[model samples]
Target: MRIVVADDSFLLREGLQLLLAEAGHDVVASVADGPAFVAAMREHRPDVGIVDVRMPPSHTDEGLRAAVDVRREWPAARLMVLSQYVEVSYAEELLAAGEGGVGYLLKDRVSDLDDFLAGLSAVAQGGTALDPLVVRQLMARRPDPLAGLTPREREVLALMAEGRSNTAIAAAMVVTPGAVEKHTQRIFAKLGLLAGDDAAHRRVLAVVRYLRAAGG
Candidate 1:
């Protein structure tokens, strides 16, 4: 997969480039800032983009905002938002990209080379990959609307929160996708969330609810 690496930190940028290249993926452009990353994407249109959340020109969510814009123009392009810490809003926006090629992970996760590459691949193939830490933080923050749910139901809801389709969730749970759909319907019923809401609305609200309750 062709990729663009964007990070203000030289070491992190070079390290990611090397990692992706070593994994036999193309690192088409290694840029130091978000604007340049955007320009590189416009020029090369890489299959995936790995961007640090904090880049130049305010050094706060520039890369994240860039990712949002990139998706707006090129919705097919995959994206990975690399954050220094557990950034809930950034993760929420990126993962709320409707189960497409989207990922939100932490810098520490880069140390797990195989998992990191797997995450990129997941995004490249139009999947969602949220960092465990981000998930934990988010799970901690939202009030639990489904606290009354069974442990099994909670598991299904967590997967749903990750934007997994019913089929995908069922596959993960080794059950019929319809079963997963039923669990999802039950979860929403318990949470009082209406069915047929768009992915963004479902996800952001899910995050809000999870943080309120989990605190785990």
Candidate 2:
């Protein structure tokens, strides 16, 4: 896989480059600031981009804004953002860009190389990989709409929001695929999401609803 890394921290940026290279992936470009990150994206068009939520200048949301710009200009760009804290608004903004190929993880997660790499891989393959902490924050912020759901239903919906497929959700929940499908249907109905023949579209709608209800 080809990757582009953007972070204001010199040590973290260099460490990521070395880490990806050691993992047999090509680090096409490593940049420091948001503008350079955008330029690298246009020039290299890497398979996946790993970006810090904050960058140079204000060290505020420069990297996140760059990610949004890249997504706008290049809709197919896959992005995995690392943040020091769980910001529901930022996660909402990132998810609002599209259905999949996006991730929002906390910086602490970087120490778990396997999980971090898996998240990037998932995003590159057109899937979502939100950090568990972010999910919990979102869930904790608003619980009214979800209050109507059964505990089992809530569990299934949470995994759906994480972009898990039915099979994956089933395996994780230790249930059969048919049971997973049934739970998904109930979730959609309870959430008032329109029933559709397109599975992916329905899944996206469900996730969007989940995020919105969670104060995203």
Candidate 3:
């Protein structure tokens, strides 16, 4: 995949460039701040971009704001935002900006190279890849939407929010794939997601609803 690395830290920017290159992906552009990130996105039009949540001058939400701007100008642009901590509001804004092709991962996760690469790949393929910690924090913030779900179904929903596939959810929960499917179906029903809707779309909608209250 073609990509861009955006962060105020020179080390992080270069680290990501090198990491992506080693993974056999092209790092088309690397920039230091939000404005430069936006310009690089326009110039390179990479498949996905890796952006830090805080950058430059303010060190608060500039990169994320620029990501939102990119999505606004080019709806198809994909981005994976890395934050040092669990910033639910930032995740809300990033996810709310587009239907898919967006990710919010903690910086710590980068050390787990395999997981980080998988998350990046997921986002590039037009799928959501939310950090597990972010999902857990969001769940703790809001229990109202989950009132109708059973305990098992809730676990399923949490994994779904992490952008896990049914097989993955099953493995994580030590359950059968069919069991996971049933739980997901019930989650859809309780969430009022149309049964006829695209499965992937419904999954993203469910996660979006879960985070929607975070902004409030």
lDDT of each: 0.75, 0.84, 0.85
lDDT of 3 by residue, 98-176 (tens): 6788888999889999999999998898888888888777667755555788888877877887889999999999999
Off by over 4 Å in 1: 145-150, 159-216
- Better by TM-score, candidate 2 or 1: 2
Q: Model 2: residues >4 Å from true position, as ranges?
A: 144-149, 163-178, 188-205
Summarize candidate 1's per-residue lDDT along 110-158 as a digit string, tens digits. Answer: 7888778877887787666677677767766765555589888988867
Positional deviation of 114 in candidate 3, in angstroms? Answer: 1.0
**lDDT string, candidate 2, 12-131, tens digits:** 999999999888999999999999999999999999898898898999899988998888899889999999986667666677676678888898878999888888888887777888
Candidate 3 has a TM-score of 0.89
* Cα displacement (Å) at residue 171, model 2: 6.4
- The numbered model that scores best in TM-score is 3
- Relative to the true structure, candidate 1 reaches a TM of 0.71
* Top-down TM-score ranking: 3, 2, 1
